[model samples]
Target chain A: MENHERSIRLPDNGNKVKAMQQKLLGVAVIAIIFVAWFIAARIISKPLVLPDFVETMQQFFKGWVDSRTMSNLGITLKRVLTGSAYAVLVGTVIGLLMGYSTKVMMAVSPIVNSIRQIPIMAWVPLSIIWFGLGEGPTVFLIFMSAVFPLIINTVSGVTGIDPNYINAARSMGAGTVAIYRDVIIPGTLPSFLTGLRLAVGSGWMSVICAEFIATSKGFGFLMIEAQERMQTSKLYALMIMSAIVGFVIDQLIRLLEKRLTSWRFKNGKAVG
Target chain B: MARLSVDGVTKVFEEKGKEPHVVLENLRFDIEEGQFISLLGPSGCGKTTLLTMMGGFQAPTSGKILLDGVPVEGPSSERGYVFQNYALFPWMTVEKNVAYGMKFSSMSAKEKQEKLKRLIEIAHLQGHEKKYPIQLSGGMQQRAAVARALAGQPKVLLLDEPLGAVDFQMRELMQNELEHMVREAKITVVMVTHDVSESVFLSDRVIVLSSNKGRVVADVPIDLPRPRDRSSEEFDKYVFKLTNLVRRAFQERTDTTF
Candidate 1:
């Protein structure tokens, strides 16, 4: 009993120490990158070409207090969220149709595949023409980038569903709607969530690109304005902020994935 | 009237620009109420296909399956099927999985609660109600599956190599549990398996199928008492006889293929 207790107790303590070491290592890596940036900036001796890390960090902190920066950040957030929501809704429907019926898949796949082949940047001109400037073109570009991953992932998810689950549900007297609710939807959810994550990442990327070309606001606009004015420190600050936001968004989706599919992670491994 | 009857069922697979393949030919069997029947055969003998047809998952190319004199059309709650994989919904907890079919059952809330409680008890899953299927071991998953199928209180339960996925050590314990569960439920069961000893142990009648075209080669009855000793002379004799028959069927399949 004493040996067993020590064996169990040791791992818990070991895990805590391991986690602490990982966190410290992460902090050390960031510190090293900042130091490298500082040294590189001094050696380059050109503020326009490479801003000092300390000055850029100051700019980053100042931007947090600036209302214009915050408002622009909010706008970018709203555009990306709106575009992603629409993509998820529309893509899921099309995906379900494609997955359920061979006729629909055959009809839609060729067109979808062809369109998906075109880069998100290539769509900007068409989007601007179709929707005009400002939020319209920007949101459209985000949607275009995001929807393909969602659609493709949802289709694979549906197609890859175990037939046994469907059969089991059917044998349990589940009708069409019940089968969807209990079997198909839950069965396809992990893949769908994975698709959503990829979609959102791509959507975030295209939104900034769209803003750079088509919009007068957002982080893209702020960065462009800083660059044109040779505010190298501010430009670097905006880039860092954008990256942090993107990281946070991805983390939020992972949290949501965990929340929605708690059953999959109950034993620290994906079941089924 | 039989609880379930397969009347001259034949399954043929037709592919475009290819000769039709015969999976099972002129197969006929009747399962009486409360009798444990096993369709024993080698792999590729269409036993799984036969079981699937019996559960109304697919249609036979010719003839029909009658359940209580009514034609089996499609999957219904009246016939519960336990797949080899123990296909419990990964998203639902063991309790919810067991209680799933009860939603469509005519049993009242009180009756369902009682039935669910008893099933969990018999399946030996009392403490793990809230746990998901993936959290359970192979034996536990199989037990939960059995509970889920029995929850519907179906007229007959069909199994497709139910213990095939479980580890060798757990198989015996599961078999004993299965026997007890069946005894308690007193429901008719039709199981498909390749294990000769398993068929002899669990089945009232073992319908041996030839590997070539899945024809019934022998229909042997097990006269052993409940919880029979596996090492007993009588048990070994039955296992030995059935093993030989299955081996011969396997040889015939190989000879025909070459």
Candidate 2:
């Protein structure tokens, strides 16, 4: 019996050790990627095509303190925030309507699905014609890119709510408005948060594409300028900066999701 | 007048291009005020459909359900329901969930608070008030559901397999808690369950339904005293009889289909 007990204990310790090993393996993968990039850069031996890893690293550190880089980052952040905020608000309202009423869903889903199928770049010409150049067109593109994902996810979220919750609310004398406020809204929150995350990620990418093609004043434009002047290392640095900012924003949103939907993560197991 | 009455209740499911299927046909029963009744049957016997209809979650196809001589038009606080899965709002704390049913009630602030406190005490969920439903055990979640249902001071309580989710040991404990809570509240109850032993132990009367068309099969009164002994021969006899009835009903359904 004692030996059997000891054998059962072994796997519990093994699981912890296995988890630690996985973390180390992730770090090792990052190290290997950096080493491979350095080696490939040496073989190419052309800074214009692929700058040396050390040179790019130096430029990357320098870009952090560069006022020009900082301003471009701020511009991009503003556009993403503005577009995504509007998307979240409108998406939630329409999604709730669609989920609650089959008539609205039947009417709206066809148009929404067709519009979403069109690629973001395909709308650039139309956006420019409607809004002119600079911030207007770029922001419009971002909005168009972000809103559809939010709408789709929000609709699914609302439709996915357990019918029991609605019945329970009704049994407690909750009317249509009260049910929307108490049962439908809170129930759809987890899915809405997921939609927000996806929306932001896509919005960030759309803003860059929009700036590259239609605007003169954001991070994407800055990258284009660096490329034209053959400042290869600086261009690499700008790309890295864009990636780091996107990573940070994604992380913050994830943190916000954790904070807002704390109920989902309680008890060390997700209940709903 | 009866506290609740089902007048020729029938339910039909109509699917596109398919025949209209009758799940329950002319189910008629009356529940007296402050009596504990259980709707017992095999699976797919429409016991839950009957319970949902009683709670006004669904309307019958061709008949009406009346509560105190008034037909149930829709769901209202007068008929509180407890679901099998204990549908407590995951976002809210236990106290908030319990207070939810009374949000629009006419009770004054003080009375509501006092009732809330008493309910928490009754459900034995004092320390767990601030915890979310996801953080609770199966039994505690069920208790929280009952507390929420009772918060409205409902005239009748409708339960749909209230103990179905709990483990065997926990089921017995929750059954006792449920009986105690119902007695204290003095509310009429209509519980739907497939467990014969459970119905015999907690109900004043058990109305068994046949599986094929959800027709009434048996109406047996327990006639036993309070805090009934589950291990007693009398209790076992009731269990055995109901179990056989439920089994035969299920067999009839299978035999016809095959």
Question: For every model shown, what is its TM-score relative to the native structure?
Answer: 0.95, 0.94
lDDT of 2 by residue, B117-201 (tens): 9999999999888888977778789889999999998999999999997889889989999998899888999999988999998
Best prediction by lDDT: 1
| lDDT tens digits, residue span A133-229, model 2 | 8888888887888888788888888999989999999998888998899988988888888888889999999899899889899999998899889
lDDT of 1 by residue, A1-272 (tens): 35754676688788889999999999899999999999999999899989988999999999998999999999998999999999999999999889878999999999999999998999999999999989999899889989999999999998988899999999999999998888888888999999999999999988999999898999799989999999999999999999899989999999889878889863443433
DockQ of candidates 1 onward, in order?
Answer: 0.58, 0.55
Model 1 Cα shift for residue A220 (angstroms): 1.1
The A-chain TM-scores of all the candidates are 0.91, 0.90
lDDT of each: 0.90, 0.89
| DockQ of structure 2 | 0.55
Question: Interface RMSD computed for candidate 2 is what?
Answer: 3.3
Error of 2 at A175 (Å): 1.1
What overall lDDT, based on C-alpha atoms, would model 2 receive against the true structure?
A: 0.89
